[model samples]
Target chain A: MFEWNAYLIIIAAVAGLFFATAVAALVWAVKNGQFSNLEQGARSIFDAEEPEGIQQDFFPGEADEQRAKLEKERRPS
Target chain B: MSPLLSFFSSIDPKARPGIPVKVQLSEIDESMRTPSILFLSAAVCWLVIGSFFALVASIKLHSPDFLANVEWLTFGRARSAHLNAMAFGWANNAIFAVSLWIMARLCKTAVRHGGLLIIAGIFWNIGVTIGVIGILTGGLTSVEWLEMPPQVAPILAFSYILIGVWGVIAFRFRQLGHVYVSQWYILAALFWFPWLYIIAQTMIFIEPARGTVQAITNWWFAHNVLGLWFTPVGLGAIYYFLPKVLGRPIYSYYLSVLGFWSLALFYNWAGVHHLIGGPIPVWLISAGIVASVMMVIPVIVTAINHHFTAVGNARATWASPTLRFIVFGAMSYTLASLFGSGMALRDVNVVTHFTQFTVGHAHHGVYAFFTMVMYGSIYFMMPRMLNREWPSAALIKTHFWCCAIGIGIMLVGLHVGGWIQGMMMNELTPDGNPKYTFLEVVHALVPWLFSRSVSGVLLTIGHIAFFVHFFWMLAGPKISRYREGPTLLLDSIRGEGKAG
Candidate 1:
């Protein structure tokens, strides 16, 4: 049988309950949109691309000229 | 010229075949390049210097008389320099470069005025170089990681502020929907580091606190710097790469948040666990022990998420060097954190404290978890940044195996030696006379010392190979056209199957 000091046991129980609540709250946050689009947001502070992913911004910006340069770089005559 | 020649000459087809080749050249923000390059070059220099110190320290451990009389190359100084270089120069700079790239690419914006970042890199390197020299010249402050002389500390402080300001500005301009898990960690780490750094510097050095208060603050700062600053960036990179390489969404967003918040709340308090059983306050020790145990929640959640995400795609381990190193590092993070929590228990700490077990444990965290992930970042980066394939795949493999085995042997040896040392230290005669002397205990661990030397050599070999391969790739070579070179191991393997 566990030797339980009443006060100490009560403290331990309270602490455990607090931690469990905290854990539950964190899980909820992750399920919501907290973890999504992390990298995009970190860098988006610099440019005003369409709020969508990098793929979406390609058509509107300097994508055309960059595409030409890439095409030129790849052609091996 | 043959039509093939003409076709080759006109080879600017503008896109990677099959993959989206229409990458905007402007997307490769020129502003970010110089800062990244500066950080990388400085990191390489620090790696070399750190490795050299490691060689000396390992040799000293094996052969105490090897440099018995040399004041500069003593175990104390050499070990400090080695750790400083690895932390400040290698790991910190690598994180900075990757952070810059990730910020640029994710935001789809060039760094606004990257001049400050470059200056930060220069000042950071200068501070570290001076700090390392100061350590060798007997000017070390004798702090564990902050052994830098007073002269260099302020310089480093200034550099951190400058570098951190750029990140703050970048965070402000962040685009919506791009605010992913990795970005949160990066932003938090950037803010957390300077606050932690400045407060500790002020409390510990600028206005010296009372005797044990400094030690308390030191523990708080060191633990948080590792947990809050370095761990965040490494985890951020893993978050990015895991999804990118697996081509899958993370297993659960819920788990990611659970992992992050739990870490933020618990890890800062757990550093004092290192001082358990020492003369620290009883309440502080209790708090640290509780926090350490609570860390398991985050570790377990993160591990499950990573493992589930990585399931079925285990083949990527062999195919993509980046994934292999990063995923392995992610696994090590679990291992290190778990080991740390266990060691925090009073029973375990009794056996592991003041022994090689602690050393082994720290390496598992620093090298296996952090450095391995950095390697993955670099592997992913070099090809994209340089617009070329790695010069030789064989060298990459060699570097991987060497680092892996070196750390493995080092940890195993340390564990055994530490256990023996702990047990022997525990043994005392009935009359209060010790059964075995300290020297005797030292003699008992000689074999482990030799093993450590062997492991150090293996690690050195890996570092040297990595350094060479990186330089070679940076120095581009002329090659024939029409050879649509595959970038990743997975791609090459798939290509081989097609050819067959």
Candidate 2:
């Protein structure tokens, strides 16, 4: 016997343990309100400086007027 | 219509569907700079080294005697060295820089002990350097993903834990509120990777599992390293950057949650598919196939989430280099995962198993999907971290086009070539003899392998441009204009502005 059966048993036990741990994580995530406030969670990465609406990235050759216009639009009035 | 200097059509910058936040990115960016610079600089050096090894290995496949005079550059050793260098060297270090920075930003917690991370990164790089040299000098192991000698394992594992803990610490002290989707992906990957690595090392190397257990364990570990470790880190970066660049939230938060959990649950089980037609139990193989097919749910879910978010912003995605790279990578993720699911079927596996088809698919996932995503992250992260824009937009464009075209050529050549080779090998004479002699098949594959090598050269050129551009920003003059302007992709290539 190559102890194949024993290996299977160990595999089964480990599988059960992982499943249980995954379930626990899911439960904790749900209970901790991790699943709530769905849209707000999506927006949480933004900030006042690099605020959400304005596109922060662009090429350097913007006409001076266009650049000034964007800077003005981005400022909090 | 009177034209008084275009009085009526005022510039109304189109606002993307975006979200607002409370904290300053500058504070978080400052916290990330110390550790991230060390990780990223080291990663760039490794990328160059890995690219060299990759070119050498690829060349040797078609022309075996090309480097025959040098023993270390033999195909077997060179190929393994390339994989180890890229995997442990470039990819892991990039993840440490990009994913960890994203975690800290989303966590809203400064990395408390930044010095610890620098130390861990040093040791990790040192360990990889040693392992790579050892592989070249004939200490290579039989294990697939764990090819690094037994001595290198402990150093990598310990250092990785120290580095991974910084992420966990940030999560622990996170501002108590909504856990962003990016944070979920980052956190899960951090926890999962170390566990998978440690278990794999113990089972296959430390104690040495017996009989068929070793083979099974090897595939289990190797496949999951891609599925659970690299895939999550790459996906997490995509989720974070897409929104930041496009100024929009993910299309559906609930669907993101679904995508994440399903990926975590099914991916680990999918590893056994690598052992199809092996001596493993039929039931085990079936389990793997089922899990791999089930992966389509999350892949499609993620694709929809990202595509819709970036749908109307096509022009922006093209103009902004960061968005350009990220979107390409995201699209590749969908293609690679679908191709993977298809290959997992019994009939498909029978054809693709040991052929160049598998090799092509590996690059599709690892390079096209993961590596490109990392490139996008570097382009985004470096400007913010250095407080300066990229030095040359032309070079960035060069890097992107070369890599995109290179990998595309590679995929077509390898897959198409492999399919023909596999069919010829499988052709049986009436007496069940192989129809094509092995030498004939080898002769047939020369052109495809040469195409792969050609792609490697293009990729190496792209890599060099990226490497030079990275340092140029860090070391170049500290002019005020370059400091303020973000390098973009719109300017005419010849007469580019001061950012040139």
Highest DockQ scorer: 2
lDDT tens digits by residue: candidate 2, B218-297? 88778888988889888989988888876667788788889988987778788889989998889989999999999999
**Model 1 spans with C-alpha error above 4 angstroms:** A1-77, B1-31, B430-433, B478-500
Stretches of candidate 2 exceeding 4 Å from the true structure:
A59-77, B1-23, B479-484, B487-500
lDDT for each candidate structure: 0.72, 0.81
The ten-residue window of minimal lDDT in model 2 chain A covers A59-68
Using alpha carbons, what is the TM-score of model 1? 0.81
Candidate 1 positional error at B210, Å? 0.4
Residue pairs of candidate 2 with colliding backbone atoms: none
Q: Single out the weakest 10-residue window by summed lDDT for candidate 1 chain B.
A: B480-489
lDDT of 1 by residue, B1-500 (tens): 79877644332323125433223323444456678778876777677778889889978876889887999989999998898888888988988888767665654444655776787888898898898899899998866778878678789888988887666665555444446667667866886777677767776788765556567677777877778888888888887767665445677756775677777656767778878888767887899899899999988998898888787655444456777788889999999989989999999999899998898888888888988998887877665555456767688888889999998999899888989988888888999887889999989988998898999989999988988887776676744111233233333343334323
Write the residue-wise lDDT of candidate 2 on A1-77 in tens digits.
Answer: 33765665666565566567667778889999888788788887666555565455554343233344544544555
RMSD of each predicted structure = 11.8, 10.9
